[model samples]
Target: MSIENDLTEFISRDVVPEGGVTETELLISSGKVDSLGLLQILGFIEQQYGVTLLTSGSPKDFESVQTLASAIRKARGESA
Candidate 1:
């Protein structure tokens, strides 16, 4: 599975178990994801991608599956 797919599945099971996330869905702003959930996501990105992402603590970084994937790619020195 791709980064977006992985995040979507993980968020669905662990974060927002009630309503699954879409690639373009609002996560943090929508209140579907909280601080703890954000930490879980960051940890997942670090462990799964082998990249300890240094972020600006921007909600945009954790906005959606698409944005998160882009952030992860950027952290890995890949084009976002």
Candidate 2:
């Protein structure tokens, strides 16, 4: 599956807890993800892509599925 699709599924299955809507463009910082939730996402990324993703600047930097997919692509050395 594409990174975007994989991330969307991960968010739907994991980040949002038992059952919640997961919109790809939804802002993660808008209470959809808390601190613990961010850790879950990072952990998922690490396991799925076998790469560490550093959230260097801001939480907003990783606020959407599209952004997460971009990070995955960059880690895999694919053009972002």
Candidate 3:
């Protein structure tokens, strides 16, 4: 699976688990994810992509699957 798809699935299963989410769905602002959910997302990122994410940033910037995929690509030094 691609990064976007992977993230969508992980977020849906591990993050939301209720109504679930689409790739372009609202993430942070949807109010479904709390601080603990954010931590789970970060952990999934590190474990799946071998990249450490998050430090001091706005959660609103998380956005959705497309946004997160771009961040992961950028972190890996891969072109969009």
Candidate 4:
């Protein structure tokens, strides 16, 4: 599957429980995703796309589907 499809599925399964995942949604602050969810997402990206997420201090990196897709593309040596 494409990145967008993979991301959509990930969000649906891991982030959005009741409603559908909006691309503009605030994943963390909206309480749709927590720290553990972020970690699980990181792991999923690593295992599925050969991406390694190494965050220094920015929790905002994992805050949205767009951001996560960008990070995953970067980690895979691809341009977002």
What TM-score should be assigned to candidate 3? 0.88
Positional deviation of 61 in candidate 1, in angstroms? 1.2
lDDT of each: 0.84, 0.72, 0.82, 0.73
Scored by lDDT, model 3 comes in at: 0.82
- Candidate 1 lDDT over 41-80, as tens digits, reads 8888888997665554355787789988998888778998
**Candidate 2 residues 3-80, lDDT tens each?**
777877887787775565354556455677777877887888888888677644245448788877776777678998
How many clashes in each candidate? 0, 0, 0, 0
Q: List runs of model 3 lying over 4 Å from the truth.
A: 56-61
**Candidate with more favorable, higher TM-score: 2 or 4:** 2
Winning candidate number (lDDT): 1
**Clashing residue pairs for model 1:** none
TM-score of each: 0.87, 0.78, 0.88, 0.77
- Model 3 pairs in collision: none
Residue-wise C-alpha lDDT for candidate 4, range 1-76, written one tens digit per residue = 7776787788787756667576667788888877777677778877887777765325666777777787777766
As a whole number from 0 to 100, the lDDT of residue 61 in candidate 3 is: 41
Please provide, for model 3 over 1-80, each residue's C-alpha lDDT reduced to its tens digit, 9 standing for 90 to 100.
79999998998898899988898887878887788998899899889988776863345448887888877887788985
**Residue pairs in steric clash, candidate 4?**
none
